[model samples]
Target: MIPTKLIPRTAEASEPPLLIKSLLAQSLKYEPQREIVYRDLFRMNYVEFNQRVRRLANVLAELGVKPGDTVAVLDWDSHRYLECFFGVTSAGAILHTVNVRLSPAQILYTMNHAEDKVVLIHEDFLPILTAIKDQLTTVDKFVVLSDKVYGETAPDVLSGIADYFSGEYEALLKEASSDYDFPDFDENTWATTFYTTGTTGNPKGVYFSHRQLFMHTMGLLTYIIGYEAMPFKGSTDVYMPITPMFHVHAWGFPFLATMMSAKQVYPGRYEPELLLKLLIKEGVTLSHCVPTILNMLVSSPAAQKFRDNLSRWKVLIGGSALTKGLAQAATDLGITVMSGYGMSETAPVMAVGYLNEQEQQLPKEDQLELRTRAGRISPFIEMRLMDDEGNFVPHDGHSLGEIVARGPWLTQGYYNDPERGAELWKGGWLHTGDVASISPDYWVMIADRTKDVIKTGGEWVSSLDMENILSQVEGVAESAVIGLPDARWGERPHALIVQKPGYNLTAEAIKSGLKDQVERGELHKWYVPDRILFVPEIPKTSVGKIDKKRIRSEMKEQILTS
Candidate 1:
């Protein structure tokens, strides 16, 4: 075996660590005047934003937050939260962006598991904190974030635990100096932590180091900027994140946008009307979200008025599969829509849909088909499909297998659960648990989640494929397909659909539509759902993916009772 060579460092050599603070510094140097807006409440440039971040670091120090301490943030998407992305990590503390959408018990479980020492909570979530404050083992201080001013007393909801209150967010920052010297630390130091929104047990903890996040940001920038075929995102682009910041660093775009010095907008809470208003008023050019939020935006009555302004928007959909129907709807509005694929464990981005020059010349419909796929493997990412027997599957666009990936930025393991961590990285690759196929040209088409794929009569059926076909059907608003127990077949596919307003859709009509797909060879005969149930809504996880586990459970109960 050949010995690996090593390079010795000189005493005078300056090797600065790739830290989160460097991103802020680069943004200030490039475009200090670029605006960072927070839902019409506040607006500051990169310079001012940098100052607030420094003040936040100083405040943490005053609150006795030492390096390696966990500081949890419970707030809507706002400028303050953006500051914490850099402030807490740059100061050497781990920033735990608490998913405020989780139930009270789940939220408490995450906080306690993380052993959060300080909490910066929004006023709206005071009741949740009030309910669980007694159970919080390590938290010693609380800082309130609010749009309104609280003079001397805390809000009514904090009546019982006001003694634990440190101060308000703005008040603490104002008191702290804006020029603390942020110390440089090892790039491999853990910078941020959050819990995954799993369906079964307590959410698993995922943490990232400074180097991992920095590289993730750079990897996404290389794809978005280096490839002209990809969605247009540049320094001049006005960026807003519809995806909650709590989720995988908002897919790591906040850091990328900051590094590029793009104008940033943070919509405080996701209101359809407010998001639309911000799109027009702030001239938001680039954004990313799940399919449900995009559907809500395009289908909203408020969006009808701003169609002209929104025509220039470019959206990257992820956190779930992007159905052809939803992609077409967004495209019809002149919005540039594409899909990407990742999970909570992969630092959340491994591939994004883009068309090469040759493929871009194809018909619009063909292009849309490619754009809605899971996308090609991203730069610096090594991806392969492994069959059930652990052999590598060919990228023939037909053979299906679970997607496993190896990348510099992929999470090393779940924070404190070595048993699950070992399972996640069983073969030196992160198992994505996604059933998919890769084309010869490296395009990834996700068939279904490993657990969500239906096996009917020993034939596999992709729920995503079925739902995509149903989405194109007339009068179908949104759809979800789950496997139900069967007597003869191992399992049968059942679809729960949300009908469009003013359309009286029936099971027969939907079946007839899918039958046409079968004739056209677009769908397998067995892929058609045996039962089409019309429902008002489908349950969603905290991050907006369909809750198939929940749907499957409910249907099993109904079947037994019937």
Candidate 2:
């Protein structure tokens, strides 16, 4: 280690701990009047939101929550959920944002694994809790979250679990005192915990420290708002998160938006119509989501009707690769769309699309190509590509390697799993498991997931590349590519496609389209799928990513038989 001089600190100097409450305090100081809307149900300004957050902290304390305890919340994107984001962590308890889309068994496993002491569950998710209430060993209390009044009686789902009920969310907050001192602690304390939507076995738990989250928020603000040529977000922009808050804190936007004091809208559950309505009604200028949600919104009839209203909207696409076809579709509708890249363990944002001065002057088609890539890495992130032999791959934009990263905000390791955690951080760098080539200028173009890349005839074929090509084909609504086991080639590319309504697409037409790509040198001839199966829908993971694992398992026998 290089020796460095240390500065002497005065005894009276104060070093404030970087905590979630600090973000809330900034919002309170700057934009106390800015509103937070929850699905047309509740609307409150920052001052009131702060009171509610404080009340929630008090409520947790009254329910016997102690420092280092876990509080799990199962709800849609709502004001209540936002309150929990600040409140639970401010009180020195870890907030577990349960993925409500998981199956009952998985939900039970995650809640129990987190060792939840208090659960604040939405009425919509009560059935899920009801299914696993008997099996939960650590939960000490349950608080209901709902839009409508339960009146004198609780929902039928909570019939047998009345004793566990503390009270409803709003009622408890209303009853509790809105004054609580949020004490300062070590900045490295675990603040939030959530499990990844793993394709195999159980979802691994990942937690973030208050310091990590604070640094992530600052880094994102610097890159996204302060540095980008066409910034996706601003303090003046009205924000709505199309992504589920349960997933990586909606890619950590809630905290950033709060720190910026931007007006926020939370759609209850993602109904495309409702989302569009909120987009129109709230004048939502900035948002983020996976490509699947964007496809759903653009495909909806309401999108066309409200096309003019969406002209000012800017969306950052992540959770999966953003295809050129999807980006063009949104662009055609006058929506600004860009791609970002990160995973559940990365605090979900390591890189995002950024157009430099020269790149901004490029032609539309060239710009779209650049915008759909993973783009340049964010500030404070040290990223490099590493090969199988543990050698560093050059950033020449042609060498392929697995993307490994080290950053202040990246999860140190998986929660409570020392064995797997060691593997995750093997070389002191967090392995991202994404295969990509980085341009000399630092732009990242993702090829495919490490496990999802297809090996055919000794050549590596990127499923994501094939999917992106297929997405641009006429009449194709959605597509997914997987490697099918074969005797001759070892593995062959196979595709499942969902066609756009009113268009009948055949395998021959799709193959012809791939032939065009091959001729243009955009794809290899071997990259064409041996079989194309038109399907009603492609299975997606709980977080709306293409469930290629499920697809591969389901299609293997079917393709072999066929």
Candidate 3:
């Protein structure tokens, strides 16, 4: 647990503190020759990267981006995006990341909700902004992010903007101040804001303070050190964040890279084929993305060509549970896959499945199992599972409860949305809404989501458990379990399955295959899915998560029609 001391002590006169500005200052000192590579551009040293960031800050100030004002970036993961990550924070502005996958309506809702003053959007996403421009309330200027992808902006895309600027983002760095004093930024000042995917309701905005982000960056150093087998050198490694920049700060990789002076690689638009090619050509040592993205990479026909490169890659999987099947497939092809868990509220990194000194002695199989569960909490995070009454659950591997967490990095409240914020921080704990069980070793097995758990005959059934088991079937590629409306019981399990290509499957066959578990007491009779529907594809949310809400909605429509 972190001490109650909220303020970090200032370093002695001879030494500076480990703030982001100091980190950049020091990187230029030691790693001056290290390369920082993006998809279409590259810089050879920290001096270049640092200067560019400072220039961006100066440009932002010139454009009337005041302290504490929200500056939203709607762009792909590019060199400019990474620069904005540091430049925006250094300028004392909050960087709000708009998920490009969101529909125009949702994009408008989030922008209006955050009160973003300036939107720095990629020229490619212009169509989306055009659709929602009439609905936005807070945007005062439009700064277009130009790249090689869109050589020149379309005439209609640039129309009706209050102020618009286009050209290279790196140019701002050259023309602006190289040595202006960084503000005496308060740690509590907002650094970044992100909108939740909003499965249950409209997307809610959550922002993190500079102190929280700084702490998270420091904590991840241990996690990278644990990746020694496929080592990452602050100089030698090239990073391409497969995760979107807007999503949990791309799981804090950008912050960690800046702190450690690591070279970065950005995959502008994630095409598994393109990513695979970049992984090999660039010799990427460290990367972070969700399981589904890796699924596409490994399953892609191009995977075999990059066999040598795949074995040397180190990956951290989060955003959703990574099943054993996906892990094994990655492992078989030489990829090191580790599970990490966090919510949109926890600056999003609570635990990573990196082996500590003690766990190094565990057998390979034991280590893999440990890596599969959300590994133990990081040094800065405190986590516990508590029952509905708030009593702590024993870490006996069988006792189950909702997982709750509190840490400096956790969100204090939803941005200006008091009612939802209260619900998020109820009982003084950041409610994860994830139900799980913990082992004596402190590993967490998330059994089901609180809202997704099926209650039948006054007992709970873990949809995750059923889905995990079903996904292991030879013909099933992916599976989702959701509670369907039932008359006899409050709710019953219904399975939505996607089968592997060329495999014939039926609901009866799938049900019979799972019956052995009930006979063996691995599962109870009531836990089985009452109906199994085979679909060509499983519906996924913008973030590549199973869309159970959509499934349930479709099922309801089917029921009404019948």
Best by lDDT: 2
The TM-score values for the models, in the order shown, are 0.97, 0.97, 0.91
Question: Of the pair 1 and 3, which is ahead by TM-score?
Answer: 1
lDDT of 2 by residue, 1-562 (tens): 7999999999999999999889888887777898999887678998899899999999999999999999999999999999999999999999999999988999999999999999999888887887789999999799988777535554443675687998888778889999988999999999999998665668899999999999999988888888952364545689899999999999998998988778999998999989999999988998999999999999999999999888899999998899999999999999998888899898988888899889889999999999899978889999999999889999999999999999999898888898878988988889989999999898999999999999999999999988988898889999999998889999999999999999988999879877987899977888789989999999999999999999998899796687
Question: Model 3, range 1-562, lDDT digits (tens) per residue?
Answer: 8778565756763433334565555666666666666664444467777877878888888778998888999998887888888888877888898888888898899899888888888878888887778778888777777664343543334665534444345445556786656766567778899898766678988888887888887777665555442246776677778888889899887887876777777888888887887788778878988877887788787887778778778888888777777777788789988888897788788887757678879886677677678766676677889999989888899998999888867889998889999988888988898999987776778888898999987889988777767867887777788998789999999888887778999998878867887898877887678888888787878777788889989977876787
Indicate the residue-level lDDT of 221 in model 1: 80
lDDT of each: 0.89, 0.90, 0.79
Candidate 3 lands at a TM-score of 0.91
Q: Relative to the unseen true structure, what is the C-alpha lDDT of residue 422 in candidate 2, on a scale of 0 to 100? A: 94
Q: Write the per-residue lDDT of candidate 1 for residues 520-558, one digit (tens) a residue.
A: 997789978888889999889899999999999987887
Stretches > 4 Å off in candidate 1: 150-157, 229-233, 519-522
As for TM-score, the candidate ahead, 2 or 3, is 2
Candidate 2 ranges beyond 4 A from true positions: 150-157, 229-235, 516-522
